[model samples]
Each structure stands twice: as structure tokens, then as C-alpha cells.
Target chain A: MSFTLRFGPVFEAWRELAAGVWLTLQLSASAMLIGLLVAVVCAWAKVFGPRWSGWIVNVYVEVIRNTPFLVQIFFIFFGLPAAGIRLSPDVAALAALVVNVGAYATEIIRAGIQSIHTGQIEAGLALGLRPVQVFRLVIIKPALRAVYPALTSQFILLMLSSSVVSAISADDLTSVANNIQSRTFTSFEVYIVVTLIYLVLSLAFAGAFRAIDRRVFSYPVAR
Target chain B: MTRFPSRRALAGLALSAALAVGLSARPAAAQTVDEIKKKGVLNVGMLVDFPPFGITSLDGKPDGFDADIAKELAKSLGVRANIVPVTGPNRIPYLLTGQVDVLVASLAVTPERAKQVAFSDPYAGIRIVVYGKVGAAVKEPADLKKFAVGVARASTQDVSLSAIAPEGTNIRRFDDDASAVQALLSGQVDVIGAATPVVGEIEKIAPKGAFDTKITLREQVHGIALRPGQDDLMKAVNAFVAQQAASGALNTTFRKWLNTDLPELKKPAI
Candidate 1:
């Protein structure tokens, strides 16, 4: 059988694809930022906070990490509505991404925190630094630097997995590609272009993470 | 810093390359009536999930309107009918790749599809309608602006609804009919574009008098599909359809499945 690859239709719908890319970027970037904050708080709670708070953090981390991301998004978008909490698709996608990545990052950051010697905290206190400042300047910065590579890789995976958000009608890149494919019946061309676009996006994210690593975590540490 | 084209990036590129090769490799062979007779079985592909038109029977056999038509077609060809269950999206690929000799799948006749396969004259018809909650005041496409509409993305109903929907109409396109129907039942959408049979399925599951058809979107006719260039096979299939339609045998099957007389089946202009 002879088959011709027509990329004309895919290129013609560049605007929709562009919009999809923008939405994916927005969802990924915001999720990464907010998810990091959530991870930091949860990690602190697990490693140093009260036992009850640590147990709650453990539960949250376990539930999100063990379940599939698709089911998480479905629960937020479809299941939550039955409980009287309605969210639009984009918002739901963002929420699911944040909740998901937060759990994984919490575990990663907690591992980094556990690696820090308790003597380091005593030294910061001996030097007259307050508890909050010690936690921030001495503990978190070094812990985060230790786990930066792992955390960023997870963020990149989160970006790729955002494609699944299209299941709930989030107009992410894959959803837009699907809409175009249905209209044109150019499945091969559409997916090829989408695959390339995703590759570029992940590469771009990896580059950005590398830059952050250089700028923020390159400081000389006291032995 | 990691090197350019990291390991993960290379993996992604390799996966995409593999997918390209998989998709472009076509092993379709042209089938003829003689080939089917030689095999002594007509491999008829029909959807098992699309109820009334195509469905799995209580006894685990393929049984529905399309299945009935498929059996009749095989009988006319003097062969045993071997029904192969297919889904809506993959039905065409099943026919084009000769996985099945022909598709009595509930494939609607459309110009877009004519490029890939030859369609026999339509043997069945379905009406697409805007079904909604009983209290929603949706009378036409314009009124949809005030409502959230759900549709299976890229379906005929999606195309028709998108064309007629007023500006600012919130159309939620789910992955398939089941998802769209779920959206409606869960109150995620105020209305949904669906087929009459799907509406029937919804009625069977949803509370009685909870929802009703608000407006008809369009009527679509389904045709038996064969790989393109099978002129002899196409002729035979069309003759069978004409004979069945004239003899009222098609109507009997339609009434049995849908509980209503078959709507007029006309050859759509492609």
C-alpha cells in the first residue's frame, strides 16, 4: 500500500497547536513552582515537625505517589464535582499536576533533609541564627541543592505527563493535536509533529533547570 | 550541566521514530468476493460496544443490527459469517488492512472516509441530536451559548455542533461517547450531542424523565465498507443492500434492535 504523508493540514492549524503549547507551558510552569512550595512545606513537616503532621504528610505523599496520574486528574475533574467542588478543565489539570508532583518532590526533598547532620542545625544556632533562618539558610538550601537534579527530572516528567490532562478535555498540546487529527485524518503527521514539540518542550525545560542549578546551587559550602 | 540531547531526549526521539515506522507500514491487500468464497467465511467486522447497531449478546456472540446485516451479507455470499468485534476508531484500519474482508461496522458514509475505502449504499440510519437535562431551555444551537455542551471530540456530532454553535458556546469535547454521556449524567455539562441509540442507552441508565432530546443535529447513514478499488466486492455489497431494502428484511432487523421502523436509507453524496 502506498501512503503519502501530508503535513499541510498540521501546519495549517499552527494557531491551535501554538495555543496548546502555551496552555501546556502555563500548566507545567505554574505546577512546578507551586508544587515545589508544597513539597518544601511537606518535607519540613515530615522530617522535623510534630508526629501527627508527619503522619498526615506521609498519607498525602503515599496516596498521590502510588495512584496513577490519570486517575488523580479524573478524580479532581470528574469525581470531585459529585462532592460539590467543580473545577474547569484547565484549573483541574493544574491542580492535579500540583498535587501529584508535590508528593514525589516531598519524598525527594525529605531524603535530602535526612542527609543533613543534626550537628549542622546546632552549629547554625551556636552562630546566633534563629530557627526559621537556620532552617531556610542552612538546612533547606543545602538539602535542595543535594536533591536539585532529582527534583528537576521529576518536574520534566510532570511536564510530559501533562499530556494526559487532555483526557478531561484540557486543551493541552495533545488534545489540540487530537482535534486536528480528527478533522484532517492525518494521524501520522499530527502525532509526529506533537512528538517533536514535546521533545523540544522537555529539552527547553531541562535547559532551564540546568541554568537554575548553576545560578542557585553553585555556592561554595563550608566544610 | 548535562550534555545537549540528554538520554531522555534521545529516548523520546527513538520512540517517535519507532511510532512513525509502525504507522507508515501498511500491509493492506485487496480482497475479492472470490477470495472470501475460497475461504468459506466472510470476515465481517462490527462494533461490539455500539448497542442496537452493534453489541455483544448475552451468549457472548456478536449480535446487533450491524451483526444481523453482516450475517445476511455472508449468507447471500454462501459463506459462514465470522463476526470480528471492532471499535469505532479502529474499524476502518481493520477493513483497510484486510484484517476483515469487509466492515459491516456502523461506519457512517462521509466524503472524508471515501478516500480510504469504498462504501456500499447505506443500510442503516441514525439521528444525531442535542440531548439535555429536562429543565434546560435549549431549543436550538443559538441557545447553546447559555449551556455547557459535551461531545465526543472529532465525532460527526462534534463537527455538526461546532458548525452550528453560537460564538461563546462552551463545548466540552471528551475522548468518546461514554465520557460525554458521563459528563451529562454527572451534571458536568448541561447538554450533550449524541446519537439516538446512545440517548436510548442513556435513558436506560439515567433516571426516567431526567433528560430528553432537545434538537436534532443531523441524520447519518451507515454503509458497509471495503478497501478501495474492490469494484466487484462493492457491486455485490450494494446489490445485497438493495435486495434487503426492497424485500423489507432490513426493516425487520432495524425494528427488532431499535424498537422503531428503520429510517429511510439513501446513498449519501460523496
Candidate 2:
């Protein structure tokens, strides 16, 4: 079972691997940002929009939640081309990730939006805040604060899930590992290294989110 | 304190002995044939959508060279063949984990793979060809350094591409021929290294005059893979191949799948 592991090729491909990690981080960050926006819009629509709009949003979330991410990725990558909507591998993978993550985010954000006490809305109205303004300042911020941890966790999961994009040839971290392992015939070794790198990235993201949480909810500690 | 610890220590020792005995007494896993005979089904792992090798046809049934081989092999063993699709990265894992007995997924017998699994004597010889953009500068393996290359992930073609492709050649690896071709057609890569049939399939999907053939990378033998130490299974497979070759059934099967008469694959010494 023991074999000499080749470190030369892995080291030589360090630049490519770094580029892949950078790409994965960029993809995850961009998708999370865009997914957050989509989540907000969908959550708001469910809470305040017409009955039909709520139904549509619910359907979107349900379908996405029920289906596997692999199938969704396949549909976007393979199905879209037939429908005359083609995207580059990176664009396609990123688009699929955003859509998948946004659905999960929608549920998380909606729960937060619902938890906003009726008293807050009433206070906003009393102060002559417009409906939109009340929703933005009074409801949105506190809801976001309460659900920030869960939402950030989902974002981290999305970052880790970005490994699947390698199937579509996005040249992300896992793809680089695949190439390295095949060349070196050290599949287990390559995966172990990749898992370590992923752990580091996860910790980094967690630290970043903690910093953001402190800055955003700087008013006081809730006892 | 020592007096009380003695009883606890004795209990811990007894527990540890029981655990060790229980673990060691576990039965060894049965072989694929043994399980198949008991269950009355021979499970076969294959590539579900790779034409000419293994594929699930439009009718929702498995077909192709590997599928046919599996069916015949199972019939010889007096068990019904149950086909299961497997991707390249997963095939070996599935075989080792007993998720599938044998992987007839056009698995090439490499020295690296031979360590973890047993391969039947070569039943087919797969030719690796490089398809590049027509009039492209890559007319040979040496030219691959100057051009970007795409290849199916974990395929022999990928190995060849990595070896022959110059440093910084930007070799893009996809999970299948389809995506690799997609990359090539989109100009993401200037060349695609794959099996001859795969290259043919890619050229069909791409624009007119999109593909040009370069040098062949290794047209080595391919074999069905089983878990290592499956001596009985190996002997059975080799016997089947030998029988098929003697009966000229091997050539017929080749023609049925590849749609061409490849005499080289008409069952060599098994």
C-alpha cells in the first residue's frame, strides 16, 4: 500500500493550483454577494408582494430545495446549450451555484424577516417612514443580524460545494487535485492536501464573517 | 484511590478484550461471484453514456461493448447482469467498496491501477488521438506545448496530454468527452486528446471543419477491472474471453458496438 509520493509535479503546478484556489474564492464570494441580493428580493416578495408573487417564490424555492445540486448543475451546463443559452464553464458553474445558494438563502432570510416584531414596523410608521423605508431600516437590518450566522454558514458551505464545479472543467481547487493525483498516482495524498487547504479557507471565511458581524451589529451586546 | 481504580481498570480490560474479539471475529466479505450466486444477480459497473463503450440508450437500457460483454459474462456465470453506471473517478472506488463487482467501463490497465485492482487480459485496444482546430499549429505531440489542450478527466488521453504537453500548455480536463469538446469548440482549448470515437463524436457536435487529427498517443489494451486478489473472478473472465475469441463472438461484439471491424480488438491472447 505504500508508494513514494511525488511532490515535484505538485510543487510545479503550485501557480496553477493557486490560480484555481483564487478562482474558487472569487466564484464563491461573487456568488454569495449576488445570492444575498437574490435572497433579499425573494424574501421580501414572499413577505410583502401579492399572493401570486408569493406562490411563485415559494415554488422556486421548493423546486430548488427538493432537487439535487448535481442535477441543477447538469441542467444549466447541458440543458441550457440546447435552449440557445450557452455560457462559458466558469459562468455556467457560477450561475448554477448562485441560483442554488440563493434558494437556501431565501428560506434563511425569510425566517429572519418574519421574526421582525410588529412593534418595530408600527414605530417606523409613527415616525412617518415610508413603507419601503420602514422595511429597509427597521426590519431588514435586525432580521439580517439575527440570521447572519446561519446565512454566513450557508455561504461557507457554498464555497466548499464549489468543488463540484470541477466536473464542468472550471479549473477550481478539486480539478487541480484531480490532475495532480492522476499524474502522481497519489489520489489519497492529493485529496488529503486539498481537504487541508479547504479547512484553512473555511477558517479564513469564518474569521471574515465574524469581523463583519461585529462591525454591522456594533450597537450593543444583547444580554 | 488504587484499590477503587483496580475494579475500573479490570472492567476496562474486559471491555477492550470483548471489543477486540468482536472486531476480529467479523466474517470476511464474500466475493462478487459468491454474492451473485446467492442473490441471483451479477451487478456490473459501466459508463452509462459513453457510446461504443458503454451507454444507456434512448430506450433507457444499457447498451454498448462493455454492456454486452457484461451481459454475456454474467450469462456464462448463470446470473442475470445488472448494469450500473459509474463515472471515471468513482469506478475504482465502487469496485473496491463492493458497490459493483466488475467495472467494464473501458478501463485501461495502467501500472498504477494494477496495484489496487486485477485486470483481465486485454479485451480491447483503444487508440488515443488528438483532435485540434483545423489548420492549427499543433500537428504533433511537440506542438501541444504551444497550444491549449482539452481531455476527458482521468482518461488515458489526459495522462498522455499531461506528459507530452509542454509546461504551461494549459491542459483543460473535463469529466467527459462532451464537455471537453465544448471547451474545444468554444476555443477554450486549441486541441482535444481522446479516444478516436470520442474525437469523432466531438467533431460531429462542433462547427464545420472544427477538428483535425494529430499523432496517436498510446493505442494500448483495455480490460475489465475487478478488485485485487479476486483470483477466481480473474480466471473466470479470462476463460470467457478465450471462449469468445475461439467462437468468433468477440469480433461480432466489436462490430456491434464500435460499428467498425477492428481486427486488433477481435480478442487477443487472454
Q: Which pairs of residues have clashing backbones in candidate 1?
A: none
Task: Give the true-contact fraction for every prediction, in order.
Answer: 0.50, 0.37
Please give the distance, in angstroms, between residue A171's alpha carbon in candidate 2 and its true position after superposition: 2.3
Q: What does candidate 2's lDDT look like per residue over B1-270, in tens digits?
A: 455567889999999999999777543333746666777777788987567787778898888888899999999888889888887766776676667878888888787778777888777767888888886776667788877688888878888777777777777688877677766766666788878777656656677776778788877677888877778877888999889877988778988777776546433333
As for candidate 2, its clashing pairs are none
Candidate 2 lDDT score at position B260: 74
DockQ, all models: 0.54, 0.27
Best by DockQ: 1
lDDT of model 1, residue B123: 94
TM-score for each prediction? 0.86, 0.78
Off by over 4 Å in 1: A221-223, B1-49, B54-104, B239-253
Interface RMSD of every candidate?
1.7, 3.6
When candidate 2 is compared with the true two-chain complex, its DockQ is: 0.27
